[model samples]
Target: MSRTTRPRKGAAHGDSRPAQAARPSPPTAETVTPDGPRYLYGIVRDTAPLDVGRIGLGIVPAQVYAVSEAGLAALVSVAPGRVVDPTRAHLLGHQRVTETLLREHTVIPVAFGTVMASEAQVRALLRTAQGELSGVLDALEGKVELGLKVLWHREHLAQRLVLEDAQLLRRDDEPEAEHERRLEAAVEDRAGRDMRALLEGLRPRAAAMREHPPVGERMLLNAAFLVERPRLEPFEEKVRSLAARSDTYTFRFTGPWAPYSFVDVHLGLRDEDASLP
Candidate 1:
């Protein structure tokens, strides 16, 4: 599987790869100190003091290790600074840590650039949110997220519609706004029908599905599916079947990575809850 960049704030974006990092709500406060601030990567179920490697964010990459408490572990590295910029290097570093954990455990990904005051704060967050975190982890066990984007040849379809349907033809006395509205309605109707059919075909293979807005006019469907690890090949095969049967649509399939699209737990700190994006 190809490596993926971390999802950005507000919108979750991933390539045709298996490693899109989650976009959790960033912590509002960060202290840039020499011996404080730990960058959090994700939460897992192991309680052992596990160290992955020296593949973390920094000018000199920090060592990523697990901070365990109450049958849970938070994958973390000491921050180079408290407030990390969303640089390409930093995002990929964050992704690398999560992707590594994904190979062995069910990870609940924390948002990119998340920092706690110290290791104690990290432990505190884990101890406090243990129930919610474990519940989400149980729900996502052995599951991987897959993304599919279907784009149709709109101009080609429009030409076919003009020849095959009377409604697609320009009416003699229709106003421009009315004509535009009718055309848009037609597009939506057609896209909706096509998307629904595609969803129905693949829904059985997925435990859950989330749909995102199409990026452009030619894009008909942009969605993510949560599939079991053992059924990945079957899911890919199904996607291939659908794509093979379509002449006007092109399918972009990616992932068997961390369940970024499905995880929704937040790490709460002290007085108020710090939201994850």
Candidate 2:
């Protein structure tokens, strides 16, 4: 038997890969102190002070703020001297702050738990990356990224394909003699055909898109679309319409989120420009 498995969502695409903008590493629990490290959320254009109230990582509450330089800002909060855990609460807290900015601004989101030793280090990073960061922000202005994942049920898809083209299977009733490799191959072929039909329905509404490799065998499509603000409704409506049009495949749709897949930000272990302790 040829069995298939799915990895945890967002895990197959490891985040340690190089990205575009340089950022501070997450603070270490042993070396951090309350009021010392600033936890980074994302980078934004100059904006009014934000006050969402006490959603920071760690045990105590932290005030989120922006360290701005040359019209760019790094949204951050004081940390309570601990390494931020990848707990549900912390991840949601990271996303909540970024989503808040998305309502009125285009931002370059940082990974969860990112931290700077001090606000001054964050300011220096903003100053150093100003030119490149501004260009990216300009490109992303008035746009947001939407995530779409398609998971296909092999048996259901094979059945649908058999109907669409009865010749898809040589013998419909010979289940006992079926070869495992052949069955898996057949499923893979049907998935490609379905992917084409889905993309034809989505690409027109997106300004740009990034396709991540599918996570597992059942995943037919895993992608992020960068869409203009004006086209968001049309894009979302199209997804709904497509969902209504199918049962063989399931659609997982999300966001108006920061363009994480599309943004090119890479801060390394020793990003010389990121020197602010």
Candidate 3:
């Protein structure tokens, strides 16, 4: 799923990195600005301080780096304001940061537009949530998220079903509309069964699976799988086999992505003062 290398054994979960002592000292008042809020990307366990790159959102893209506390680190950048707008560029920047980290670490992605007042607030968050954060990090270690979608040409499948099944054939005595309703029901049943079979084939390869509502009538399955790094190739192979087995349905596959759907922690921050749309 990812061409990026994995961390050394025990590194992804946690290491013996000294906590706040290893982190860079906070800027003195004379050199620091008054209202420079921190825009958080995500968190990883027990890593030494790192500079991710210049991929943050703003008038001028800011440099992203880690702030450590209690053996955990948050990837953050100095934001232009307290309220970072969720514009296309900004959202992509946020996603890029997380995806970049996912290449080497199991990221606990924070909510989009999460901004704290200063390094103190960010470190405070890591310090306060250390136990909960560490537990989630352990569960997600060495895994990545992948997405799948299946869609079909409804009219084509319906016609084929009618031709193949005697029960599905239109009767001269049956009204055209009534026959159409029966065809719709048959398509729904068939799609459901097919979706189940697809999931069953790959379920054993995943640590966790999430189902999203299909977007259109033609779409039958929309799902995400949390797969271990070692199992990635096999998981992808299973998907390919399933797609090849069905010519009637169109399959779309994506990702070696950050585990956006898997992390369940809430930061419980209040943003009442911001003018976020």
* Predicted structure 3, TM vs. truth: 0.87
Task: List lDDT for all candidates, in order.
Answer: 0.73, 0.68, 0.76
lDDT of 3 by residue, 104-167 (tens): 6778887788788887778778777788888888888788888888889988888878878989
* C-alpha TM-scores of all predictions: 0.80, 0.77, 0.87
Better of 2 and 3 by lDDT: 3
Pick by lDDT: which candidate is best?
3
Better of 1 and 3 by TM-score: 3
Clashing pairs in 3: none
Candidate 2 Cα errors over 4 Å, as ranges: 1-35, 58-61, 164-184, 267-277
lDDT of 2: 0.68
* Residue-by-residue lDDT tens digits, candidate 2, 161-205: 667875556665666446445656777876787788888878888
Q: In candidate 3, which residue ranges exceed 4 Å CA deviation?
A: 1-22, 25-31, 269-277
Q: Against the true structure, what is every candidate's RMSD?
A: 8.6, 9.4, 4.0
Total backbone clashes of candidate 1, pairs 3 or more residues apart or in separate chains: 6
